[model samples]
Target: MHRKALLTLLKEHHPVTADEKAMTQATIEFVEANPACFERTLLIGHITASALIVSPDRQQVVLIHHRKLDRWLQPGGHADGDPDSRAVAFREAEEETGLTSLKLVSPAILDVDIHPIPARGDVPEHLHYDIRFLFEADPTEPFKLNEEVKDVQWVALNTITTRTNSVSVLRMVQKIN
Candidate 1:
């Protein structure tokens, strides 16, 4: 049922760029081909969910310094066996950022990305079909960082480049603008 919901979301997603279009197609194909796409045990790759959390006024975005990756990124994580990407995104964001007043910007998917995660410990390198959602939260709300992240900050949208040079992050900023 969750897979079907994702399919419907992809169908209505209307990607914002050619790269996103390609990623959307790849995600559809991957999800369709793998029944256990939500399971991290699928060493080849697996589905992940993320939240592009923005300030209530939309001028700033919440970024987390991922402990393991040693880089700044949006709040997100593995779906485990849960297929509801929307819920996963919200849950991961709340857990990672400790923002209690998060509001879903929309029910629609904000973006889709397929990126490779490097091998770590016993885990092999694999692709992450990341489903992203837009969310709004009060930037003034103090965030309690969890073990998954080192720090959390509200970055001005114009100065996002200082945090990370991820192409996907820039693309999302463009979409927001």
Candidate 2:
């Protein structure tokens, strides 16, 4: 989406708080002032969401072993112009994991995690502002892994912390417990 269009949408949907407005404005100005920055980035500067999908038993969490990153990550992706981050998180989670019976919790789990994208082939580094949500699903929900993922599993939360998962994923587990 164009930077101006995104800003206008944000203004209309985002909480009309001073800080939020200022941040939105600043982001717009940055993009406008530095087109090169936008070109270099993989994902445009906009809101995005992800989900930490937990089982009904709450003992395990759905995770994807990302082939590109080679680490366990929650199912999520860009908002794709969706103003509602929670809906974005849910959509991506369902699409990537193929779990349709998931339920999003009210007072949606929220967090901001920024990470640098590794240099891939000729693409340079970029960053993602991951807004995460917590969701619940039946313990036996069927899963069909997408090609974007190397593997998917319902891993015990404790096991995730022991492995080399991203700090954001680890922090998510900590927050839930």
Question: For this target, which candidate reaches the highest TM-score against the unseen true structure?
Answer: 1
Query: Could you give candidate 2's per-residue lDDT for residues 1-177 as a string of tens digits?
Result: 445543454345442345434544555555456534323343434455789988877788888887778877898887655556677788889888989888986543344555667667866565665567789888687788888888888889778765545766776776566
The superposed Cα distance between candidate 1 and the true structure at residue 141, in angstroms, equals 0.7
Please give, for residues 82-133, the per-residue lDDT of candidate 1 as tens digits.
Answer: 9899899999999999999999999999999999999999999999999999
lDDT of candidate 2 at residue 103, scale 0 to 100: 91
Candidate 2, residue 74: the lDDT equals 90
- Runs in model 2 with CA error above 4 Å? 1-46
lDDT of 1: 0.92
Tell me how many residue pairs clash in candidate 1: 0
